[model samples]
Structures are given as structure tokens and as C-alpha cells.
Target: MGSAKWIACVSLVCLLGVLSRGAAAENDFGDFSLSRSEWSSEYMSLDSGHFLDRKLLQVQPSSQTQLLAVRGDRRDPLDNFRKYRGGYDVTNKHYWASVVYTGIYGFAIGVAWLLLGALITLGACFKLCCCRRPKVAERRSRAYYWIPRILAFLLSLFAIGVIITMFVRNSQLHDRAFKVRDSIAASANDATSTVRNVSNTLSNVDTTVSKYNIEGLNSSTLSSTVRNLNQQADSIDNTVDNNVNTINKLINGIEITLIVLLSIALFLVVMGLLSALMGWRTIYFLIILLGWLIAALTWILFGIFFAANNVTSDTCQAFSEYLATPSNTTLDELLPCVDLATAASASNVVRQGVNNIVAQAERSLTQIEQTSAALGRPVTLPTVCDPIGPAPAFEYNSNCPNGTVTLGGLPGVVAPFVCAAEPVTQACLGAGQFVSRTNDTQIRDLSSAGQSLVTIIPTVTRLTNCSIVYNTFEDIVNNQCPPTKRALRNIWIPLLLLSIALTLLSLDWIFANHRNKKERYASGRDPEAYNNVPK
Candidate 1:
């Protein structure tokens, strides 16, 4: 009988589910009928799918037909450049085609024609027993050499374009990148500050917890544990603060370098153009100096990567040490430190103390309001946090200068403040003034509670940002620095090689002078022919 009832119940549920879904389906199609149809949009239409990822869809009214589209930032500069290079057809096909047309077809063909005519005249002289001088070969040779010089000149022009492009893209890159860096830095600062706050809160919590003796923890031993936790927090704070500055400087230096590179490219281009057009012998030597400049910038990036890696390794080790079990140590001995994992857990004693304090505050506030009522004076129960204007300035100190801010601190307010304990001096605080006084106090107290759990949030965020640790020191052996480093090497190293090559090619003019070349040919010292000329 039970089994039969169970089967009947299941069948009834299935029937109900099917009927409900059918009703829902019918409701869905209610807006569209045979004769009339209505269109209601939840999200706006996005048409630039090819260029952008997910865009913010507009919420349209009944009369509106189109939605506005939002755009995001561009991809990495190097990736854009790779596509741009292809778009401009800077490939071997074009490069070799240019070389072939200028060298093989134009210069080579014209030089051969001159040489053939010169040879024909020399042959007639020998055949008619009227020996003539060997043909003038200097001008044709110089023009032949002009082709490679022209190529060098073109390479320099391309370098200038690359420099300008890099400057523009790097500026864009910094515009986007610094925002990310600032965000990461802000998180690191907040995390570091929070850790320190927790440490200070722990000291007060331990004292409060000991007074109630809620757990079987010894006051002295608990103090020792809190001290250890605080020490670790301090170390982390120092490390994070130092590395943040280092990373900021590294990024700023890189930004400035793009401009310096642009200047250098402009200078080298002027030198190269002069070398090719006017045969400026000294100008070719400047390429050697340009090569050295490239090497210096390359090494600086490597240094930054090294520093980040070193910091990462030390942080990982310290974090692991804090998490590991102490030798023959009891759980009571390492209360806070033992629980410092990627996710840290707070003690019940701290939670109890916070509750006790909050209860005491509530009672105090009630007593004041009751006394006011008893005296027949106006009593505002549950006090409103209306700011009585900016906090009063201390007797000796000056007022806030020139401007007012709502967050952090007011200009004249003293440091080491507790919420609502001290008067605020800042102007321009509206709802926030009340928030700091009334509504947020409980939430702040809850955050201050020891029993809450928090993920070890700072390590991964700060470490992985710019791969501060891995790229700087740890991951170099494994070849895992930011791909930008490799892309930069690809650009500057080839430039250096070209600089050296062009300088070497230009060395020929140093040894063989233009004036001496014709003299040697006229004196038969050029060695093209051994036939003696009759005087």
C-alpha cells in the first residue's frame, strides 16, 4: 500500500511540473499573437562584436529603437604592432622586391652597360695597336655602393618610425597600465594597513579576552602568541611598502625611456641620412654609441625582473613558516600564527570581547538619553550622526588649508583616532559624516570582530601583479618573465645589430679616399689591366 502511494505521489508531481512548465511557456508567448506582436528588450543591442568583447547593454524605453554601445581599451601594444606590421607589408617579399628593383634591375644593369661600353673601347685600342688607358671605374663603383647606403638610410628611417610608434603606444600602455598598478598598489597598501590594524586589534582583544577568561588560554601565553603574529605582520608591511615603491619607479623609468628612445632614434636618423647623402665619414661612428645605449636599457629591465623574483621568494618562505607547525608546540602557544593560512580564522574570545564592548556602548547611550528625558530636556534616542560641521581644530594647530576632503582624515584632526571617539574637522562630508558616526559603526565593529575569517588576500594580488616576485628573481631560470621583456629584446637587439653592420659597411670610405681612387687608376696602380701605354 505504501509503495503504491509513493508511485501515485511521484506521478502527480510529474503531472504538476509538466502543467506548470506548459503554463510558463504559454505566458512567454503571450506577448506575441497571430495578429499583434510586442518587443520588450532586457539588454541593448551590441553591433561592434568584431572589435570589442562584451559591452554594456543599454536599457531602452518602449519608444527607443537602438542602444548605446560602450568601448573598452585596446590590446597590448606589441600585439597591435604585429598586426600593423603585417598591414603595412613589412615582409621579405617587399624587402627583397625593393632590393631587387634598386640593386639587381636598376644599379646593376646600368653599371654593367657602362662597363661593357668601356671594355669595347679598350678592345679596339688593343686591336688597332693603339693602347689606351684602363677605363675610369671610380664613379660607377661609387654609384654601385650607393644602393647599400640607400638601404642603410631606409633602415634608419624605419627605426625612427618604430621609435615614434613605440612612444605613442607606450604612452597609451602607461595610461592603462598605471591605473592597474595604482589599483594593485592601493590593494597592497590597504592589505598592509589592515594587517597592522588586526595586529593592534589583537593586542587589545587579548587583554579583553583575558579579563573574561572565556577560554582556557593563559594571558601571558596569549600575549606571546599575539606578539609573534604582530612581528610577522610588521615584516609583511615593510616588504610590501618597499616593493611598491620599487615597482612604481620601475614603471615610471620605463615610461621615460620610451621618450629617450624616440630622441635617440631621431638623432640616429639625422646621422644616417647625412651619411648616405653627403658621405659623412664621422657620422657612421655614432652608430657604435647608439648600440651601447640600447644595451644599457635592456639590462635595466632585466634588473627589475630580478628584484621582483627575490622579493617573491622571501615572502613565500615567510608565509610558509608562519603556517607550519612549531616543534613540540601546543595549539594554545600559536593561536593566531597557527591559523594564518591563505584563509585565517579568528578566535571566539575576540568575538566575545567585541560583543561585550558594543553592549556597554549601547547601555551608555541609553543612560544618557534616559537622563535627558528625566530632566524634561529633548532626548534623541539612537543618536543621529549629523556632523556639526567639520571637526573643531585643536587650540595650537592650523585649520585645513585651501581644500577639503571627505575620506581618510580631515586636515586639522589629530592622528590615532577611534570612530566616534574624536570630533571630525573636515568640511564637505555629507552622508559620510553620518556614516562614520552612526550607521557604519556596527559594520566597522563587525569587521573588527576577531571571529571573522579572511583570505590571505594580499600575497597573491601583489605578487602576481606585474609578476613582481616571479619575474624579478624566481622565474628567470624558468624563462617566465613578462613577455614584454622578450618583445623589447626582439626590437632593440636587431636595431643594435643593424647599427654595427652599417658602421662596418661605411668603413670602406675611411681606407680608400675619393681623390686617391682616381689617381691610383690613372697611374695604372688600380690593377685592372697590365697592358703598357705607349708615351
Candidate 2:
């Protein structure tokens, strides 16, 4: 029963191997025909398979122009229209130009605000120092006395609220940035590990081929295939390492910039508030001037982040479209499909090598049995399955011919013959040893090679199909894109709002300070004026 079970298992592995080979024969790129069930089972962790339909494997447009044509003009006229409106093709050029324009727009607004604040500060200083005050200060209403103070207090409160919200948004942006970094690192690692596993497996297969030295099998094709795969894996590994290093540096720089800019903005706001409250006219004016410059810097940063967000969105959309139909697109140029011939040839070599080993073992067993019988210690040895047929291909049929035994059952069948045979003669002893060695070593090695080949087929299939990169892109589109875009918006939108609020607060502080100073001077000029002043 144990032998029968073992036979059934080996048979199943061979059957699956043959089926995979047949599937490979059907497609130039080797079994890329992923069924819905396969996709669900194999890629459920990616969370992007559901976004794809049966058409996920369909050939995509051959070039960027073809892809753009197929997708049609998807631009939002209102949102995307600018100086480069005619060049809006949603390509990198368009989005990058949009970024430049956005930065310029933000810079222009910031500079205008800075100029306005400068003029106000200069005018107020001139009125206080260069121009003479009226001999009698005009009587002001109670509403006028309290309104500016009330407005200043309200604006200060609003600015504080905005600052707190900006901090929260910035924290979220930091979290999202780290998550993006981790996701990319993880994906690259996964691809690297998968390729490494395949390279190792190919090496093992090569080792097995050389160790066994199966007759009638050519090692050249197998060696060349293994060498090519290893080289490819090494190239891929190096590329991933370089890209990851570059991206890590970029993300680290962005994070540092975020920290520095926010810290500066916060420091400026706090100092401006302190100077205004303490009635230090010179320090307050200096703070206001610095605030204008800082506000302008924040606007420029906001523009940069906004552009990044737009480009990210555009890239995500383009990638998602490619996922829906990946073949023949420009993405193919970036990530070429696996070579079908190399994959098929490797599998065929292993299969044929296994078959050759089995056939050679059977021929040795037959000679040993005949020699044992002629030497007066006649013993029947177990038989291996005939060389696997090309037509009516090898399936799960383990039942041997009338006089032979199944490949897996050979050991069991040979076991009793060797154990029961006596070493009555040197010739009989020699025959038994040959039979034992053939059964124990060569047949065992053949089975091991078959099992190894079984594993190699699927790994080769996956590599050739480009499913690793496919799944990575799917993960980017489904898992990474939305949160990244939201995080970018959170950062830039809060920055823009904070810049505007801080600018307004500066203006309010200047006006309130000027009014207080004028009131103090007027009160000093007349006791009646001091008496008339509201408490």
C-alpha cells in the first residue's frame, strides 16, 4: 500500500509536469493564460487582482502614442488647462510643465503678499516716525477701540487652529511617506528573493544533471539555460538595488526638508506673536518682515508638493491602465517578458534527462537478472516504466505492463530478491550487488531529479510570465496610489492655508500695535484725553 501511494504521488507530479509543458507549448511566453481562479488564489494578498478582469493578460498598445490614442484624451479641460494646454497629453512632459507652472503661480502669489506686507510695514513706520501726528487726536468710538483688538484676538486664535491642523496633516504625510518607502522596499525585496530562488533552483537542476550523467541527454542546452537565467537574475538584483538606494535617498531628503520647513514656519509664527504681544516695535516689524519671507517659502513648498501629487495621480492612472492590458505597451520595454524558448527548453531537458536515467536503469536491471539466472541463482528483478511516450503523453497511469513493475514500486519488488538470494557463488554475489546498486542509487537519483524538475516548471513559468512585476505594479495601483495622493494633498493644502492665515495675522498685529501706540501718545498730551480713553 505504501509503495502504491508513492507510485501515485510520483505519477501525479509527472502528470502535472506534462500538463504545464503542454500549456507552455500553447503560448509563446509560456502559460500566461491566468484563469480567474488562479489569479484569486495566487494574488489575493496583492488586493489588486479584483480590479482586473479576464482581459488583464490581453496585449496592450505597442507604444506610448498608441496607448494614449487607445485611452483617448482624458484631460479635464478646466483643471488641466494652462500655458501648455495644447500639449496636455497626460505624459510626464505635461505633468512636469504643470508642476513648473504651479510653482511659479505659488511663488508669484507669495511674492505679492510679501510686497504688500512690506508696503504696509513701511507706511506704518513712516507715519509713526517721519510724519507729524495731529495736535489733537481725533475722538474714537468705543466700537473702534475694541474692534481691531477683537479682530486681532480672533485672527490669532484662527492662526493657532490652522497651525495645529497643519501639524496633524504633516504627521499624516510623514506616516504615508514612510509607508510608501516600506511598500516599495518590500516589493523590490520580494522580486529579488523570487528571482534568487529561481536562480538557485536552476543551479540545483544543473548540479543534478552533472551528478547523474544520464545517457543520451545533452548538458549544453541545460548549462546555457542556467547561465542565462543566473545572469538575468543578477542583472535584475543589481537594478533593484540601485533603484532602491536612489529612492531611499530621495525620500530621506524629502522628509528632512519637510521637518526643516515646518520647524522654521512654527518658529517664525511663535516669535511674531511674542514680539507683537510685548509691544517691541522694532522687533515686531522685523518679525513681520521675516514672516512674509517664510510665508512665501511655504507657498513654494506647497506648489512643489502639489505638483508631486498631480504627477503621482497621473502615473497611477497610467499604470492602472497598463495593468488592465499589459502586453505590447511601453511598460514592456521597461520590463520585458520572459523568454519562452529558454523556459521550455530547460523543462524539456530535465524531463528528457529523467526519462534517460530511468531507461538506462531498466536496461542494467535486465542484464543483472539474466546474469543471475544463468549462474544458477536465478532471480527476477523489478522493472521500471517504459520511456515516457510523446503521444498519449505520460499521465497518472502507474500500472506497469504484464511482466514489469511501476518505477516507484521497483525498490519494493527488488527488496525480496536481494534479501532472499544466497551468495552461493561469486557470480551470483556480483549480480545481486549490481541489482542493489541500480535500484538503491540510480533509480533513487532518477526520482529525485523528477521531483526537482516538477518544482522547476512552476518557478520557470512564473518567471517567464512576468507575474512578479505584474503583481508589484498591481499593488502600487491598488494599495499605494490613493493614500500617497491624499497624504501629498494634506501636506500642501495645509501649507497654503497656514501661509495665508499667518500673513493675515501679521497685518492684524501691526494695525493693533499702531493703534495702541497712538492712544498712549495722545493720552500723554492731555489729561482730558486720558480721562476720555476707555478702560
Candidate 3:
């Protein structure tokens, strides 16, 4: 005992003397930047399935042009518009509160148990020579020693409860989700009705939006006009309907994945409990301890990812906000008519054809007006539904060669329209044409030839409704984007606390095992007596 006491005094003096020397410089110089200003850039993307600027499809042309102007127009901002056409984005709802608390408790238990195990094990082994055991020691260990194990179990249960609670809370949101979905469907239906209303209204306007009703024309221009109008309306309808279907699919996929994940987790939990209950507690401890390390590493990695994507998170939030507005404000201004613009401007030939047709229609309207100049007098035209120069002529189709034919084979001039299907002779072409109509219909309208242009505004307006909902694959991206906020507060700090928990729990478990083994003799006899007597 005297020798042990002397050794302890000398060790304490040496430790104090070493610490007093202020410890060798732990860090080399230049480890940190001594700067007043710092600039950083992150390559985080808004869509996990893509990288960088490629996912921004519905870019505001105005904004892009603005950027171009800022850069002195050296770059074409339109070049940046790239569409994302991928499968459903996977989602993660970060359950921070529950995750952090559970981890904190585990870490603390590990630390406490490790300490307890080390101290008690050393004392029992008589390694601390001065601390001699009593000859008549208590036969059993104190109930207080089991507190850490009990607390660990209790805390584990609490974490499970928290997870269950989150599921419950989100289940309510699912109810809300159904309502929101129905509302969006209603909105789409209303927009469809509005387009039909515009069509019916335009039919009443004279020479402005209706057909000229020229007689016996092989290709019925009026029917074609109505067909085009209906086609535009249908595109709006189809785009929204497709978007809704995709969203539904996404939800179904998420539900399935979540179910699979939870089932696996439950299986792990059950196996762990079964092991412990069956007295293979050491194995159970190892399972839980190793499981905790893996889980901690996973969470810490995820937390780092969330922290790194600060800009992407903000952009996702901005996208959400952009979609929420119902007005024709900047949101409307920015995105409205863009689909039509993209479809229309996709080819220079198509634009030129559209221009020529518009010019011819104007000329026809003027000539007809001059011939019928008598006030309130109606004049029958010498010819109705005249060719109008076939501005939107097909450059390619059944009989026409792709890229070699344009504007119905204008030869020298650029053909404005191009057809991807059979020629207009055998097929009407495009969507309205695609909807199934005869190439040569005798049906004609009594309205002016130029009147068909009125469908543009209504078509554009209806199309904007598609953008108001889940228009693309980014819906899930926005939903799942990780926020940089609260990671340190909700994740890392709690993880640190969890490390503390783990340390404590390890000590308790280790010490308790020794206590059980040390007292496993007749009437708490010392080791020497137990070795010699009644055996």
C-alpha cells in the first residue's frame, strides 16, 4: 500500500510538470488563412440526378437575356436551357429532432459505461494496490449500477417513439396532399374549360378569329385552323395530366421505398432484442455498438452534405415559392408562353413559314376588305380559302425527304413548316393532324382567313397552368433538397452528445460484468479463501 501511494504521488507530480510546460505547439503555423475577405463557390446542383446548370429548363428568357446583357452579350443565355427528363427523384425527410436526441443518448451512455468499466475492473483486480477490498463485502452489486443499461433501453424506446410520431405527423400531411392534388386537378380542368371558352368566343368575332368559310377547298383551311387550336389546347391538357401522373408515381415509389427501409430497420431491432433477451448480451452489445458507429458515420456524412449544399437548398426553396404563386405576376411573366416559344422557335424554317402565312393572310384580308368597302355591305369573294402561299408547308414526311423539302417544296425559298409524318396529301400532319383527320376535307368556314390567330393568347395562358404544378422531374428534387441550417445544432452536436452516451454506457456495461463475476463466490469471500475452501 505504501509503495502504491508513493507511485501515485510521483505520477501526479510528473503529469503536472509536463502540463505546466504548456504542451508542444499542437499546430504548425499557416494552418489557417489570415484574411479579411473570403470567396467560395460550390458545385452543388438543384437536382441530384443532374449537375450544375443543366436542370434549369424553365429559365426566364428575360432573366437569361438580362445575364447576357450584363456579360455584354458575349454568351447566349439560351444555350443554358437544358431539360431534365428523368425518372422520379428519391426523397429524404430529415428527422433531425429524433435522430439527434437518440444519438446523443447513445454517445453519452458509451462514454459513461467505458469509464465505469475501467475504474471498477482496475479496483477489483487490485491493480490500485492501496484500495483494498473488505473481507466481508456485500454479496450482491447495488441496483444503482444498472441505471445506465436501463436508461439506454428507455432512450432507445424514446427514439422509436419519436420516429413513430414523425410518421404520424407526415401521415396527416398525406391527407393534405390528397386535397392539394385534387385542387390542382380542378385547376387544370378549369384551364381546359377556359381554352374551350376562348375557341367558342372567337367563333363569334367577325374576320378576326373565325374562318373565311371558302367553298370546296381540297385542304380545308378552317378545319385545319380549328384543328391547330384544339391541338394547342390538348398540349396544355396533356402536359398537366402527364405531370400529375408522374407525381402520383413518385409518391407511390416513395411509399414503397420507405416501407422497405422501415421493415429492414425493424428486423435489425428485433434481432438485437432477441439476442439480449436470450442472454447473449455481449453479442448484443457488440451489435449495438458497431451499429451505432455505422449509423453515426452515415448521419455525419449526410449532415456534411446538407451543410455543403447551402446554395442548392436556397434554390430549391426559391423553386417552391415560384410554384406556389397563382397570379400572373413575375412567376407568370417568367414562365408563361415559354413552352409555346420553345416549340415554335425550335426551327428557323418554321418561324419563316409562320411569318409568310401571316403576311399572306393580311394581304387576303386587305383585298377582301377593299372589294367589300360599302358600309355594312357584305361581299362574296371571287375565291375563298386560297392557298395563302402554304407558309406552313411540310418539308419532310411520307413523300418528302427530311431536311431536303420545306414550305411544301418551295424549291429555292426556305420551306417554313416541316412534317415528321406522311405528307399533308396523305396526312394532315402535327398534333391536330396527329389526332386523326382526313388530308382533304371539304368542310370550310364562313369566317375570315386571318381570324385563326386569336387562339395564341388563350393557348399560352392555359399552357402556363402546367407550370403551376409538378411540371418536371425537379418536384422531388425540390422536396428533398438538404438545408445547410441546423446541421451543427441538430446533427453534429447531438452526435457529440451521443458519443458521450456511448462512452458512458460502455463503462457501465463493462463494470457491471466485473461486479457480477467478482461477487460469484461463497458469501463474498476473497479470491484466496474461495480458491482453498469447500471446493
Q: What is the lDDT of every predicted structure here?
A: 0.34, 0.53, 0.33
In model 1, where do residues sit more than 4 Å from their true spots? 1-142, 172-183, 206-210, 216-222, 252-262, 282-535
RMSD of each: 24.2, 11.9, 24.9
lDDT value for model 2: 0.53
* Candidate 2 residue lDDT tens string, 1-535: 2211110001100010111211111211112121111111122111133322322433333332224112223343345553433222332354345444655657777778777877876897798898865444556776665665676566666666777777677777667766765665565565556556655664575555454444323344455655665666666566556555555566667667867776776776666565555656677667767767777777777777775665566556756776766544434333344443444344455445545556655665676577667756787665766434432223222244777665455556555444223323455465444344433454454455545554554454445445665676677779887887888787778778877777676677667556555444442477357556554
- Runs in model 3 deviating more than 4 A are 1-145, 173-246, 256-279, 282-290, 297-336, 339-535
TM-score of each: 0.37, 0.66, 0.37
Give the per-residue lDDT digits (tens) of candidate 1, residues 1-535. Answer: 2211110001100000000001111211012111111111111111112101111111223232121111122121334312211111112242223212322222333344345435644685586686545553343444554655566566566656655665665665455435434544444454445445545555564443343322212255345545654565565556445555555665577578756755665665566556555655455445534533443333333333332232223222322332231111111111111221111112222222223333333443454456445545434534211111121210111233333321112111211122352343343122123223432333233223322211211221221121222122232223322333344444344434433433333333223222223222454455553233210
Q: What clash count goes with each model?
A: 9, 0, 42
Model 3 compared with the native: what TM-score? 0.37
Which pairs clash in the backbone of model 1?
305-472, 306-472, 308-469, 309-469, 309-472, 309-473, 342-456, 391-424, 391-425
| Tens digit of per-residue lDDT, candidate 3, span 272-390 | 44443343455655655544443443344334323323322333443354344322222222123324222222222122223333333334334434533432334332222222223
Predictions ranked by lDDT, top down? 2, 1, 3
Compute the lDDT of residue 535 as modeled in candidate 2.
40
